[model samples]
Target: MNDFLLYEKTGGVVILTMNRPEQRNALSSVEICEEFEDRCRSIERDPSVNALIITGAGPVFCAGGDIKKMRDRSGFAPAKTVIDTRDSYRNSIHRIPKALYNLEVPTIAAVNGAAIGAGLDLACMCDMRISATHAVFAESFIKLGIVPGDGGAWFLPRIVGYSMACEMALTGVQIDAEEARRIGLVSRVVDGAALMEQALELARRIDAMPGRTLRLTKRLLRDSGQLSLDHHLEMAGAFQTISHETEDHREALAAVFEKRAPSFSNR
Candidate 1:
């Protein structure tokens, strides 16, 4: 709905492109945050959407927060008082991670260029990341004399491990795509020209599965990180029961025996 972000849905795969090349796709304001949150909600409600790929429109993925807005005390920057600033963060930027974390479908970040500060955290929030050869990343909040107030501490450590997260955060150093892949920050790195094609190819492969099953699988994977093995087993059993009863499951089995392509109703 907004020019800052472009939403394109093809069959069951959704691609959200941060469309502010002039501003380097900055996470500039609360309005932009709301746009992301709203689109996430829309994807969750749409049964046909099996996967999501987020990328930037132009050269840079995102520049993090807007320095101009920060200096002027506008957008999601400091407010008139300490209490208001805290409330602002909770009300504005925090919505992104919450919305993304709770989304049912699988999500991927296609890092075409630089992803810094909040931008890096945004990529970390996704289920997977694919980076271009020229991509750059930095947990640069410390460089700005601040910390990641938008849940970077939690997500970054989960993606890149505690020690590496500390190195990135404390040092505010940038890493290239190859280094990101070496540290497992990104799953794959391709040429910048082929980034979207590869990302969409992966997404389409994911979309070929039964929709309900895909969502359930993603839910189990996300929950397993925070859950005890025993608890996860119980939850997995419940999810399996749901999957077992679906029409798609029957079709999948029938196709295997018949040696034919399965057509799913996504039930």
Candidate 2:
């Protein structure tokens, strides 16, 4: 892990902390994006890690892009042409969402404070979101005279519906944690001091499940949005067949009959 990103694991849950409190954990530098992608890949290969929780180091969850870098064009790159700028986004910032979207394990965004612009989209990339009472969210790209260049356009609508997503994106207004929860953007809200505890508690519940089952279930959910009902049912059938053959499945069945907890080895 780099200085800007901190990685720690306890049992089946891995916590990823954006460590740049000074910058409000802004996803501005190429290094931050690269490190994020690398960590996603690492987690994908680790079966022992059944869940992930993303949070920031300080009060601010993330402030999105670095304004100074955008003005100076130093954080991205020196791009003289439109094509250069386009490629910079494709090869740099875009990688974070692509990598995250493909990650096999379940992920939770523990929004500690401000999640603005691309930062809010970053939280949306996760499978679930839980916010602190002090946290705020916004699809704030319009405020900067830009659009959702970092997949916010694609993600926000799915979480908060088309009308609400449009309202936020078009107006670039900030919403409190309670509003976020009410709109279904975040699943729950907790006291600022209990944010991580709440997130970790949820992570542990998810992590206790069979690892392969969790991955397959997540994949099914991801594809369900795009798949027809017939196709989705077929895919689910195939996955269910494969899952039934796993030792973890047998253990789960045995535990049910024995009235005991299942000990899953992630098999």
Candidate 3:
């Protein structure tokens, strides 16, 4: 829907490409933030969307915030005071994580290159991450004398444990794809040329599931982190009750007994 972000659909899978190659797909402006929020809402409303893959347009995944804009205190909603700055972040850049978090579809971050500062946090926002061999990542906001005002602190620690998150946040050191994989930041790392192919393949595999149940499963997994065992089991039981009543669930069982591939209506 916007120039900075490209939306493409192949069957039930959607791909969102950060299309600002000239700017290294930096999360620099309010427009990019709006684009991400809008597209995510659209995807959520569309029942046909079962999976999402997010990646950058060019060699760089995302350079984080625009340093020039930051230096001048001019991007997103430019503010002249502390209160105004807080409001600006809440109104602008913060929308991406909130939107992505609320999105029902399973999400994947296909990291093609550098993911620095807020960029690294953006990848952490997704359910799964796959990286290209040439990709590098860092919690580099400390290097700029700015903390992650976009909720990176919350996400980074959740994705990579507290101690590793502390090291990355405090030192602002960059790590390669293999290091990311070893640290459980990315599940897989492949050649740069095959990144999208690998991501799409993974997305398509997930897309083959029954749609309603897939969304419910994702919601359960996400909410489980904040829930006690008893509360999570109660919620899971309620969701499973709904799943069992769907036509797709019946078809799945029938297919297993018949020894045939199941075709989900995604009900």
Candidate 4:
């Protein structure tokens, strides 16, 4: 929308780029929060946009919050200020994790470089992730003498297990792309220059899929987190019912029977 953030729709993909290259594309200032949310909401509202890819300009993805701003705000230390800051982080830039959780379309994070603190949290929100081999992830909040305020605490443990999350949070250690792939933090990693190439390639392949199934499957996965195995199996049956009834499913079945490639309408 503005220089701070930009969105471009191409085919079934919506690319949301963080535009603060001078600041490593960090979402530090409060000015762009509303704009950021509005753009993301627009993406959600578009049924034609089947996937969302978040990345930054320049080399680095983000370096987390503005340290100078944090230090300046620390002098007050009132409970209300602390609460408001936390809320601001969530409502503004850090809510991607939560919003992506409920998004009807799949989301991906193309990590071009360092993703520290809130940047890492943003990655964890994506349905899948691709990163440059030169990219790194850092649980850097502890280095600033604080805990993971947004979705980092929840996402890290689920992604890499509790022990790893604890170690990463407490020590603020940075994990390279290989380690991230090993620990399941990322789906794929490639050369720095090839990061977006890989992400776009993958996005294109997935965008050609049955859109309604992907959306419902994403919703089911999110719901499975809170349900028991038996209950989830029951839920799976319910989800499948919806999936099989889509017009896309009918087309796919007919195509298979006719020995032709399925032309999906994503109905």
Best by lDDT: 1
Question: Against the true structure, candidate 2 has what lDDT?
Answer: 0.93
Which 10-residue window of candidate 3 scores lowest in summed lDDT?
A: 70-79
Query: How many clashes (backbone atoms < 3 Å, residues ≥3 apart in a chain or on different chains) does model 3 have?
Result: 0
> 1 or 3: which has the higher lDDT?
1
Model 4 clashing-pair count: 0
Off-target runs (Cα >4 Å) in candidate 2 are none
lDDT of each: 0.94, 0.93, 0.93, 0.81
User: How much lDDT does candidate 4 score?
Assistant: 0.81
Q: How well does each candidate superpose onto the true structure, as a TM-score?
A: 0.98, 0.98, 0.98, 0.92
Q: Per-residue lDDT for 1-267 in model 2, tens only?
A: 466779999999999999989999999877788899999999999999999999999889999999998889886544478888888888888999998899989999999999999899999999999999989999998988888998989989999999999999999999999999999999999999999999999999999999999999999998899999999999999999999999999999999999999999888
After superposition, the stretches of candidate 1 with alpha carbons farther than 4 Å from their true spots are: none
Q: Tell me, what's the RMSD of every candidate?
A: 0.9, 0.9, 0.9, 2.3
Error in Å for residue 170 of model 4:
0.8
lDDT of 4 by residue, 222-244 (tens): 78778999999998998898988
Candidate 1 has what TM-score? 0.98
Candidate 2 residue 129 C-alpha distance from true site, Å:
0.6
